[model samples]
Target: MSAPALERAQVQHRTVRVLALGQVLGGVAFGATVSLGALLAADISGEESLSGFATASVTLGAALCAIPLARLAAARGRRVALTLGNLFALVGIAIVITAAAMRVFPLLLVGVVLIGAGNAGNLQSRFAATDLAESAHRGRDLGVVVWATTVGGVLGPLLLTPGEALGRVVGMPPLTGAYLFSIVAQTAALALYLIALRPDPLLLAQRLARDDARVALPGADVDRPVAARYAMLAVAASHVVMASVMAMTPVHLQHLAHAGHAGHGGATEAVTLLVGITIALHVLGMYGLSPVFGWLADRWGRVRVVLLGQAVLATSLLIASTWPGERMAVVAALFLLGLGWSASTVSGAALLTESTPLAPRPRRQGMSDTLMTASAAVGAVLAGLVLGQWGYGVLALTGLALVALTTLLSPLGRR
Candidate 1:
């Protein structure tokens, strides 16, 4: 490559790194909220069922706001839309804090909803990273952002320990302190984004597109339909399956213990620990090795990687269904679930980023994320119903069916 070409490549690499760091912080905030939200809700409401509602509310809110916020980003710019998301998160944290102090369930729900909206913004950060990258590195850059998320995600749960202690000192419930910490994390995330994400990747991509136009190759000017939309659907399906299966695991475990399967102990505490570990491992699977998946997508093909991920997820669900009463079996299943999510998410995001021009990047990103979160919400709701009425077996089979559907659609993915 020529000197100018090399320099451009270097700039793109640097831009991707910066965006990845920002994504890490954002992921930390998000991970903290997800890890602690259920416990916090249960503590606040004094009802286990309310935890389901709280989780659903957050996912539902994100789903509802995703496309709209994307449109806002498209019309205005990412900086404004992202800043707005941070502000919403700030408000949501306040509501949760107030709800804790007042012991109001409804108010807490509102807070979760706002936090979900904030998540919609966080999810778009990958698209921003991709906008600044060359096609060859697009998946890799997106994966780097996903990998960055692991740092915050791992630390978020650890914060729970300190947060719980702080809650005691402040005369608030321990779970309330988790939300407070989330506020601090989110505030820092906002600052990082504001300071580092200036100029906006979408705008940069637009400029690149214009530059490419001046030195256009054959077929370069023709608008290629973005493969990201289809990839987004696959990503959403994986998330929904993961959330649905993971959500009901604790309940299923308790039933097993009741039937004299797990072992001797207070089933509740064991179940709680199991749930926490499962979530942490699940998160690990989702973020860890994401870069590898992204690289594979760019190298081998996005659709093939996505199809492989779906197959992995289907296998995990099948395992979970076959041995519902075994703790060890369940843990292994969840681990696979996490891994499948990581692969699909990383690859799917990269596909989305490559599929669109800068002008529509943010809006498309937001739309994809919204669909992703919405599917998870639907899965959560359905999981609750299936687990309550039909049994874990039925849910697993249904998840398998979805995976098959995703596989069938895999051929539609971008090269």
Candidate 2:
């Protein structure tokens, strides 16, 4: 390798490692909030219906903040943009804790939204991983950073028990104990991004571009808007399908668990256990083997992997539709749904990054992430309506149709 190539390679390695650590921290914050936000809302408001808003607030926050953060990266750099995001999350954590203590439901919503803003930044970390990446190994590099999230994601929910115990000892508000850990995690991530993340990958790439004709730019056909448009569609569609299915899995599990039971209230614990286990497994499927799919994306080609992901999504929906009442089968289907989501999302992200040039990439990525989170938010709402009216069978079938449309559109992205 030439001297400059070796230096770039070394920086890429350092960047990925640093970004991975940051992701783990962000994962901890996200996992805790997602797992407990609804429960906290219900406890605060004394209205079960209001509980759903806790989650919606977070999603809304993420979507709302995506564009501004992208613009920040475009103006300042990834370092500043990401640090501000983590800071937003940290401040939000403090507010959540205060709101819990004050018994203010509206305040809690406000805090969670900021927390979601932090998550938006975390999601952008994947793109940062690719800023200095070699085209041949782009997917693999992105996957490793994504996979690092598994540690925080899996461990965060599991810490609820310990968090509760600690909260009691510390005389903290009921479920707000988890947010304490989030505070620490977000703070650490903020520090990491500020102190490290040197030369700012986005800025460095810009310099490299100015120094030489966009040397860091990924694929040859990337300059075309149509190609980038297709890549963005892939990212958006994958999220919509994943979020639509994932958002309703808990409800489906509850229905399945209580279908013919004599007393619905009596089996609450049993149902909770079943739902938690299945959801945990689903999380594993989403993140555990991401590196494998990332490798596939690199070797097999990005378009093919995305198409394969759509196929997997179709099969999962079929299984879910065919055997909605069979508990284990549904569990298996949900797991597959996560796997397919992981494949499509990771590959689609890599594709999107490569398809856009360095100068406009930051804003474009932000637009894509905004579309992703916003569409997922909409899909989750629609899925709830479908599940409530038509049932799980119809919801799964509905998702299957959406996946088919994505598959048909996949050809447009192929080079």
Candidate 3:
């Protein structure tokens, strides 16, 4: 290989390493907050109905912040954008801790939104992995960074007991313990990005573009808006389908238990255990084998993998809707759902990175994420309504319809 190529490869390797580490640490905070946010919201509000808003705020925050963060990255660098995001989260966690002590529900909501802003940064890091990557390996690099989140995602909740103990030692409320942990984690991520993410990947890529004008880099000269538009649609649609179904799954299981279905004779503890196991398996599916999917995306092509993902999602919805009362079926459905989400997300992300030009890519990426998060937020809200009014089966059916529509309208099908 030429010297420039070798140098670029080394830089790419170093950049991905730092980004992956950040994902792991950031994932911890996100996992803890997601697991506890709804329960805490319900407790604070003294109203079960308000519990959904906690998660909704996070989603909305991500959508709201995506544009500004992308613009910042566009103007300055990924390091600045990412660090600011983590800082926002750190401050948000501090507020949450304070609100918990004060028993202030609205204040908690404010903090959670900022935490979501941090999530937007975390999401953008995956794209950063691709900025300096070779086209042939883009999927693999993106997948590796995404898979790193699995570590913290799985381990965060397990630390809840210790976190709570730490909270008590510091004279904070027990429930606020997780947020305290989040503060430390967010701070570490912020510092790492600020210090280690030097010679920012995006900026470096821009330089490479200028130095090697004759050399073709992925999406560096693409001027086709229609192609990028299609890619964005695929990303957003898949996210909406995944978020909607996932949001209401636990509630659906609980309703089945109460209705005396397969779990009719089960105790509260038994039901809770079942629900926990199912969710765990689902998360495992989401993160596990992501590298494998990335490989497939490279080998089989991104569009093909995205189509396969749509099929998997459709099958999962079918099984879930048809056998809502069956415990094993529900578990299988959720696992498949996670796998489908991974496939679509990785493939769509790579496709988007490859379809847009470098100059406009940052803002375009931000717009894609904004649309994705916003669509998911809408889907999640509608999911609750669907589950409450009709039933879990109908909700699954609705998701299936969405998948079908999205797939048909996708460039994959049109081409």
Candidate 4:
């Protein structure tokens, strides 16, 4: 409203945009690693079952370090934490390269774990963006950061096709080359973060809050015990459910194909194309409309949007459970899962940002993410066991129940 206020708002906008670009690049590297890591592990180990463990190891590492890493960011600031994250990634890439050269399975898992630690930091970038934004625009800022990830996520898999060829040229496995690309991307991300992400938005917000007491007017007094706890719970629940369904979808689809259920209607290439399309659509649902969801959270109310997300998730799971063998049905289910995830994730993040003061944001964000990732790891591990014994239908039903439970708890969330 005032001239000073208008200038501050402009600065915040610029900061969020710069951070969003860094996040996009980071997300691209992350997307590539996630999309190709399992296949790469399978190639190196020559066992499909072991690949799951390798992939799970990365998530496990992230789960273990999520809170601690966030605390580091909280204490030392984003630049240090992000640089450390990139360093971890570099080390992980080196390990993977060595594993490929020597053909070692255990070493490869260790490498993935390092990469996972880096991922935990990358996940926190959106929160950092929120620290630079006005309370009302928190969701939109977070969404922009998230939207950036889609480009890299889409490009990551496509790179794999060329990455494999490059691998042959370089005398390494195709997937090894992919890891090499991760190294370069992560290094560039780190440089961008350190050079461009200056003055630390959270720190800036904190200073601004101190100078102008009124800055804490909207949703800023959320440091109350009850609100803080509820916000943390919502963030954790949203992340866990999203991670759980995503982890299981591919495995379930693979099972159907193996059972001669899905591919029965088509050739292997067609099935492959169907799977690719499903993943692309799933990604689209996750990141495409995130800004809209954020806008909704700002306008309609955060908790209400989160509840709607949970309800949609439950419905999607129920539908999937009823038609586990149908490809189209599963695709639709995944689309809903992604949409629900987008809503919950964006809204939950905005809620967390609004509820916590600048001082405790990094720590709380870290703790919340750690719990979320841990829950997701548990869900992924359990999904494997559940799918192995009871089949895809049972897994879907189980997820439905979890979503329902989350929905029931939604009332506790901040307004």
Candidate 5:
């Protein structure tokens, strides 16, 4: 490789390392919310029905923050933007702790939203990985950052018992313990972003892309805005499909297990264990093997990988729809669903970064993240309703339709 090329590759390597560590820290917060956000809301609100709002608030927070964060990155550089995101998370988790003490519902909502803002940062970090990536390895590097989340995501909930014990000893509110651990984790993430992200990847990449102005690839003359938008849609649609399907899996598993174990002893525990394990496996599918897909995307091409993702999703949903009541079938389908989402999202993001030039990237990328979180927020609400009314089988079919639509859109992203 040329000297300049080697330098860029080295910087990209460091950037990915810092991003991966930050994600592990951020993922702790991400996983913590899944286990407690709703419960805390329900406890503080004194309304079980309103528990869902806790999760919603986080989603809304991420959606609301995406555009602003992107704009900030565009203006100030990624280090500044990412630091702000981590700061929001730190403050947000602190508020959650305070809200628990004060028994205030609204405060808790606000806090979770801020935590969601941090998650929005985590989501953006994937794109940040590509900011300096050579086109050939962009997918692999992005996949590494994406995979790092699996660690904190898994470890966060397991900390609940120990976190709660530590909280109880310190005289914290019942569920506030997790938030306490979250505060430490998020604080570390903030510090990591503030310290390690070095020299700002986005700004550096912009300069480099400007420096190497002569390099051109397939379809370089395509309208920048059109290509960018298509890439955004590909990323956003793939995300919503994953979010919508995964959101309802627990409820589906619960109902199926309940029916199957109506007369069984310890049925509640059995059902919980089943749902937990299945979801964990699904999470594994989403992130564990991402590097493999990333390599495939780099070798096989982006749009083709996107199409492959859709096929995986189609097969997953078909399995789900055909055998919704079967325990093993559902578990397998959920895992495949996660795998498909990983493939689509990873490749779609790579496409997005390359399709839009550096100058316009932050704006388009911001819009992409916003659309992802916003659509996911809406899709989750709708998925719950769909599951309640028509059942898991039909919900799977609906997700299938979404995958098919994304499949059709994938061709547009082709060079």
Candidate 6:
């Protein structure tokens, strides 16, 4: 490699490391609060219906914050935006603790919303990974950062019990114990972003791109508007499919197990364990092979990988819908569901990076994320109604239509 190329590669490497660490830390807090939000809401509101809103608030907050955060990253640089995200999370979690102590449900919801702002930061960090990356390695760089989340996401919920234990010792309210860990994890993430993400990858990349533009470097202005449109659609559709199916899996699992047990959960504990394991494996699928998919994206091309994601997601939905009563089928389907999401997301992000102008890239990226989150939220709401009114199989079938639509829109399939 040429000296400049080698240096750029090294800088990209360091940037990815810092981003990965921040992702892990942020994921820890996000995972912890998400795991506990529903339960806390149910306890505080005394209404099961209101419980969903707790989690919904976080999604809404993320959607609400995505554009602003992106704009900030555009104007002020990533370091400022990311650190601000963490600060929002820190303050929000603190408010959650106070709300719990005061027994105020509305206050808790508000706090969780702010926590979601932090999640927007976490999500954007993945794109930041690609800022300094060479086109050939962009997918890999984004993938590594995303893969890092697996560590903290897996560990976050596990900390719940320990957090509760600590809460007891510290005289914290029982329902809000998880927020304590969230505060610490978010703080660490904030500090890491502020301290280690030096010189700002986005800013550096923008300058480089501008210099290249000025010189009229070959392929510098290669535009792929069609591919970018397809990418956005694929990303949004894939997320909808994944979110809708995943939101109802636990409920479906319990119902199926009960039916098998003669309408009585004689193996309730066993069934619960099975559900937990299945979900964990699903999460693994979501993040574990991201590097491999990243490699595929760079090697094969973005649209092809997105097409593969749609195919996998369709198969998963089919299996889930066809054999709703089989636990193993459900597990396999959910795992594929996550894998498909990972493939589509990683590839779609890389495609987005390549398609847009560097100057407006962050803003557009944030806009896409806002749309993705909104689509997922809609899917989640629809999944509940579909599952409740028809059945889990029907819910999966509902998502299958979307999968097919995405397949048709795959850039490889187009002119």
Best by lDDT: 2
Instruction: Estimate the Cα RMSD of every predicted model relative to the unseen true structure.
Output: 3.4, 2.9, 3.2, 3.3, 3.4, 3.4
Indicate the worst ten consecutive residues by lDDT in candidate 6: 211-220
lDDT, each prediction: 0.72, 0.80, 0.79, 0.72, 0.78, 0.78
The ten-residue window of minimal lDDT in model 4 covers 266-275
- Quick one: how many clashes does candidate 2 have? 0
Please list all clashing residue pairs in model 1, or write none if there are none. 228-352
Question: How much is 374 displaced in model 1, in angstroms?
Answer: 1.7
Q: List the residue pairs that clash in candidate 6.
A: none
**Which regions of candidate 2 are displaced past 4 Å?**
41-52, 98-104, 214-221, 251-276, 322-327
Model 4, range 300-354, lDDT digits (tens) per residue?
Answer: 9888888878887887788788998898899898888888888888888888777
Compose the digit string of candidate 5's lDDT tens values, residues 1-415: 6666677778889999999998888777766676667557766888644555666677788899998999999888888888888888888888888899999998998998898898787788898898888777889999999898778776775666566778889999886676677878878887898888887888777666667754332232334565567777777777777777776666566567778889787655554466556766777778887888889889998888888888888899999999998999998998898888888888888878777766777888888989888887787667666776788889888877677787776657764
- The TM-score obtained by model 5 is 0.86
Clashing residue pairs in candidate 3 (N, C-alpha, C atoms within 3 angstroms):
none
How well does model 5 score by local distance difference test? 0.78
Candidate 2 versus truth, CA RMSD in Å, comes to 2.9
Cα distance off (Å), candidate 6, residue 247: 3.1
- When summed lDDT is taken over every stretch of 10 residues in candidate 3, the lowest stretch is 263-272
What does the lDDT read for residue 240 in candidate 1?
A: 84
Model 1: per-residue Cα lDDT over 131-207, one tens digit each: 55667777888888888887777666555556666877878654566566677778887887778665675655555
* Candidate 3, 1-415: lDDT as tens digits: 6776677788899999999999889877786676566556766887645556677767778899999999999889899899989987887788777777788999998988888888888889989999998888999999999888877766665555566668778887745665676777888888899999988999888888889864446558766676577778888888888777776666566555656645356343343445556666676667776778888989988878888889989999999999988889998998898888888888888888888889999999999999998877677767766776777788888887768876786664223
